[model samples]
Target: MAMKRNGKSPVSSDTDEKFMFFKDVSLGPHETQLRFRLIHFWEARNPVKKTIIGLEMLLIDEQGTVIQGFIPPGRIKKYLPDLKQGSVYRLNNFYGSKNKPMYRVADHIATVSFTWNSELSVLHEIPTCFDEDRFRFHSYEDFEANCDIKGDLYDVVGHMKLVNGHTLIERPTPDEVKIDTTRHIMVHVQSHDGPVMKLYLWDQAAADFCKKFNSYDNTPTLLLVTAVNTKRLGGTLALTSMSPSRIISTGSAQTRRLLIKQVSADVVTKPWYYIGCSGCHAKATKGATSLVCTNTKCEKINTAGVPQYRAKISVYDNSDQAVFVLLGDAGRVLTGRHASELVSSYFEANGSEGADHLVPVPEALISTIGQTHKFCVKVTQHNFSGDTRAITVTKILSLDTPSPTEASVGNDIAAMSEGATQSGDAVCEPHKGGGVTADEESKRACSSADPETAKRPRCEN
Candidate 1:
């Protein structure tokens, strides 16, 4: 039988064999030929048993109709070798089965299932063309309408506003423990002229996003995610990734900048610094003779502990106020001195009691109480935990000129001068005479067991 080159013409031969369109297929066993392009495919698994169910696929026909396809495990080897994405194929003998009601990827009513006698062959030298791909996008309002329903899965395209609360332009160093534990990337994405929404890319989708995001010289602004499940988290609309989700990012880079006032250092509630493992910079556990790294991926066994700044300060703008946690070099950026310099200077002046000695909040941090600065904050999952109001500040931006590496996403804030001194609920006054003991300081600072909670310089573990 000779196949027709033009898609409009009926594909028939002398024996009256004809090609079937996906829209015309009905629920039943069929011995007909179906021609389509394998858009994408993945292994479907039993969620509970963690066993392979079958090879699931999204196939598109010449008429631009898309439908779900499946290859049973028993016959996978027969067609797996020849199965290639984006290649047109002729599938003979398939059972038309009812489509799943939930998490439906395509709009079809039935699925094309490969049977034992199915003959799958690539259709080469096709003069006619097929649609490259298709997407079903919903606006912020549309997503909110379907939130928590677990209905049909859809695609989303938007410009990433904030990645884990940090500007997308800044590539923060990856934390092994944080990545292993969280295992997700929460991005605030905004569609064209739409409200910003949170999208959680989990597991492989997160990994794929990271890989594609870093592959470019400049950060990509436009993000296209396929097969996302909409959810309502903490009374907020959230979109999460599924097993077959694909991430595609491209466009000019953009940065998310926030302008706020540094009200006062939150010295009474939390510590200003933490003794971190020198190797990985994670909170260290105190050993009998040495400090050990809490990060299991750290190569060092008994790594020396280094004091790192983790100062929490109350910050506010004209409208809202919240606590901001200064991690790593952000303290140095805000203050002219480093945590090590302040700690060493304090110890040098006052005799060393022990490693657990609490260091007072340096005057450098206190001096900036009423200052205003543009900050590039790194928002983490901890911010959404509802336990604390702390937002992680990754970098302190200069008001002069924006960095060449960063581009403005929206309206830029005007430069503001130093504001009047504002008193906060948790203010840190200078420690006079002798520093407080570890037990006294711990009692005052310890609010929650969360590691991100500010406390004095000690081995966290």
Candidate 2:
């Protein structure tokens, strides 16, 4: 019943001239024109970094309802100029279909698509309600309350306090034909209010964050991260990025000045123990009388009752206190002994203890308590315990000159490092050559010198 200034209806006498609301777009052929303002626009890309087939658009209507639209790559160029983000447009002759629920961009059950013959016209008037941009941000209290809720995702922005080095993980596909190795990075951050949290990044996100921080300049202290997923582990709430997440900076000159002043303010204290596997240098766990390799891929065991170093120490600076575990290189720097040597010395001194019995803590390990050292730490939730948090040492820094007794230990460490380098092997940060190329059955036949072979004990059945 609506008519333009002219005598006839806008489209036709029989057709409706009133713009269709986003909520009204359903799964059917339609002659109705939809007028909406663009909220977001992006090009979809594949995992291999190829430009995919569709242009994604998030549109909002006057009623405040949001809808998603897709344009095929072939028809994208025709409507490129009018597709400017935040612009208002009236589109007609498009088809609406049910969207894939698994990767739905919006809450709507249906998505609109533009056909080759679709008509689009720019509108100058923008809706006032839809003009203000808003983000669904969660406070530290909200994260604590709903961290265990299924499928709950949040948005958070934090100032970067520390960035840890990269670590690689190899995951086997369902078919098990090849393993995909992914690089992961962790960043420690805090909000202006009071809460501190950790952000984990993978693949391109990890690489990008590291590249920015490691560059000679342009190290941003503040990062605004969106689309975060929460998880409860080892009694702490951990935040990770969802597939659609992004990081932006909100740093200022004042933050940079503060960062320089606090660089050496003695924030996190040193760790006491560095329990590592003699084989892959991954952290090991006590299993009854034996020390089991935590790396699922490594087959090493310590059934010989060799004393396993267990570093679980509480450290506190004036600002904060945290319990951190040192493993691999960080452990080595503190104890000044290789994990294998620690095991050997323990069994040598405790020859009276049966190989199948639980071994006591070695004397060398007990001496490291209360000693101070610089370390790069990452916040992680333990896999088995949801309510407990584990601070993992990623790297170590020597703050002062070594004593004569420490100098002797450093020589031994240097000799071991040299030998490990020649064999393309590393105890801590096992990326050098730790993983086995062969299958599980063939791996058992490998020699003792093989890094993977050390995961198992000689007395094991």
TM-score for every candidate vs. truth?
0.52, 0.40
lDDT of 1 by residue, 19-101 (tens): 78888777877777888898888888899998999999999988899999989988888889998989999888788899988
For model 2, how does the per-residue alpha-carbon lDDT over 1-461 read when each residue is reduced to its tens digit?
65433232323223435566667677755666777788767676775868676788777876777677888888888887777877878887777777765444466777889886789998785433454232455567877776766454555665555455211112111111111244665666664333457678655556555444444244355556655677775566778765555543335453444433442232222222234456654445679887775555667757222222335444443245465554444556777886558666667877887744433344566455334566544322241244324454545556653323445645654655533431111122223334431111111111122332122111100
Q: In every candidate, how many clashes are there?
A: 3, 13
User: Global lDDT of each model?
Assistant: 0.66, 0.52
The whole-model C-alpha lDDT of candidate 1 against the native structure comes to 0.66
Candidate 2 error regions (>4 Å): 1-17, 48-51, 127-129, 138-154, 164-186, 190-197, 200-222, 228-244, 248-461
* Candidate with maximal TM-score: 1
User: Which candidate tops lDDT?
Assistant: 1
